[model samples]
Target: MKKKVFCVLIYLQFCFIFPKTSFPGFRAWLSPYRMALGGSGYLSFSPLTNRNNPASLKSKKTFYSGLIRYPSSIMGQGLAITLPKKERVVGLAVQHLSYGTFDGYDSESISTEKYSSSDTWINFYSSKRSTWDDLKYGFAISWFKSSLAQNQINAIVFSLGLQLYLKSIDANLGISLNNHGKVFSNSSNSSGEMPKETVISSSKKLKYLPMKIFFDGIFNSRYKLDNINFGGEAKINNDLEFVWGTSLNKISQNTRQSFWKSFFAASGIGLAYNINSIKIFYSSFFLGTGTLYNGVSFEINVI
Candidate 1:
């Protein structure tokens, strides 16, 4: 069918057109809602969805959101505030990841003082509807800072995205370039290039069911890595929803293990509840290495 052919062409383009390079940092999950949906939120309706696709930054109301994540000693958290201005929406977000405290040792492995490591990102983004009613575009600029003991590095990152709504299919399609930036450091050993990625994503609401399906194709040019993520969100009621999803990396990462084991290891699940103007979300997913991570977030509409 025509749909099948179009899908194949897109896959081929992602596989062959992207160049290989090292992976970039700052790919951490920021929203529990999107995380539960298998990390495929480029076309989500939620304003708090991943900012990697800046085109999704539209909301009729101003709101603030916060989230926290736990994966053993590594902790992650983020905060975001969004406001609509005329036909455009603008937002600010900050995220932090802490790698816990570790004992620093010299080359001789002698005892040393305890030290901590962390990464932080401060982002400013805006999006607006195109002259064409069905199109939207957005851009983001971020400042990144990372520290391990005394050594630290700073970087500037940029993201751009476009989204289109197909009225006939009742679906949304989006494309984005993320984490393209310059790294600054006095250290000679560190690479000065950012890990850049291209993402194509789509989402659809089934006509006969109270559910929405999502798909994302993410290509990392630096590392030559490609990931496909798919998931679904089912409405339990007007105020409650259940979500489940998985990615290709989760299914095939542990080839030595049983197929089902690897499949379950990569799966993610979560729930969302709305109480008046406040919404709460929770998500749980496993890393490729089988580590489990849990996150919770809260959003409140200010006006």
Candidate 2:
């Protein structure tokens, strides 16, 4: 019954929160643009092997923070870093959620009160790939904050992913186990003592069925001296995707809107360029009222 409800909520969201022309709500609003454009992207997530499922993790340009995302009204930043390596590849990333401030609504009056304090939920994660065999693994631990009510929800997440690589065409099949929602706290009153010290608690914690499995593939080609990357993937159930991206291209603005605005408002093209050891690109997400995210990253040789 709960699963049925969750599905209906997502369907209803499409009608209101996410119209055919726009998507600007909650998690969708805060999501980084690059991944968003990649088909409600879970496969493009760094440190997690589930969605960031490019089979080219062994290439020369493999270990670099290929994305930096900043959303308007969002209090935190998301970082993706790839460690330098020749044989053994390591990837690390941290997504800081909530710089602070969330409004709590009073059930009686239905009035919202913004909390003066909030906790930072960060995903500390890493991945490893080497000449070991066909098995590629990745994992991470996450600290979470309140997903709903008055500081009543908080918990930790333990995640693991396994990738099975196919020899032909360089394709990959992967599965991941994740704890989607868990809450932990002390004092059922919503103002309890620390979780470790008290017997009574107000928070929630992870329980059951928090798992996801996905498959993805990527193809690289060169056109007119420029590089073209074609990639797509699907995550478990309830998510779908299809996208087109190219490098070394620009469009002329023939209107009053700014070049960037007009370029993106009309489903503009993205630019990805590699400079020596660093990879750079202009990525943005059109979610929310529309935010422009600017990002930069460098590959560091660390073991």
Candidate 3:
């Protein structure tokens, strides 16, 4: 236990002290649950699960989740509310990321002031579940915004998702196309194309054990077959759970020459505690050799 705790501390230190920039394009920070589970949330039932696979939004209860990421001190919070009627279900979600302050530099590399960056997403979705076939389909319209030092970029995207549940096998298959939209405004830097991507994911529950496993395949328009992730959760009891997973695609060596040569890739472990209608989760993962990513989230169920 002592050794494990020490390892966790070391990882957090690494995350806090390392370089802090997410990969370009659709490779932003993920939710704690998704990151903990090896980047597989396509089949998850969490209200925030739709961030990755919009089709996974089948919850009847409204949910609020807040997460914090290390290294860059990125903070994210989201809310998902569902309205269920006899005919169909309508869901609305909002997610936002705020990157902490940074030292600004001039064209000549002179230190200036400090600046902060942020990103936000708003999604409106509708989902329908087929009673006979146990199939669900969801579609969403999303608006996204990214803010830098003095420029703000905004775009609108449409996403479609499908999910199938096999009760007899206790398994689910999910797929989604996310961030397909028009770029209304171009930023100061580059073209105005939203980071569009597709994800294929599945989850399975063991009949004889208290474990759930998930697998995901991610494809980005700019980088095809960028990531493959696998993860699992083991319930220790009614209130405690253990989670572990890893991303198969390693971080690029270009990010940090030294860090890339030391660690394998992205891998992490998490623990969750649930009490009544609220759950708290914590996870840590390797981003590169010396860079680590630590995340924590609090989720609550309302209604």
Encode model 3's per-residue lDDT on 53-82: one tens digit a residue: 666675565565656465534556666676
TM-score of 1: 0.85
Give the clashing residue pairs of candidate 1, or none: 21-222, 21-223, 22-222
TM-score for candidate 2: 0.47
Evaluate all candidate structures by whole-model CA lDDT and list the values in order.
0.72, 0.37, 0.68
Residue 1 displacement (Å), model 2: 39
lDDT for residue 124 in candidate 3, whole number 0-100: 84
Best-to-worst TM-score order: 1, 3, 2
User: Model 2, range 1-303, lDDT digits (tens) per residue?
Assistant: 343344334334433432321111112222233432332223345442222332223323344343333332333344555553555444554544332344455768575765532233455455556476776666656665543234344567555555666666344455444433345653334532211100000111113422222222322111112112222222223322223222111122123356555444313123344454443444443322233444433343333
Clash count, candidate 1: 3
Q: All candidates' TM-scores?
A: 0.85, 0.47, 0.79
Candidate 2 has an lDDT of 0.37
Task: Estimate, for each residue in 11-125, the C-alpha lDDT of model 1 and write its tens digit.
Answer: 2322332324322225455567777876776677443433458887866555556564544345667777888898998988877766556666899999789777677888888
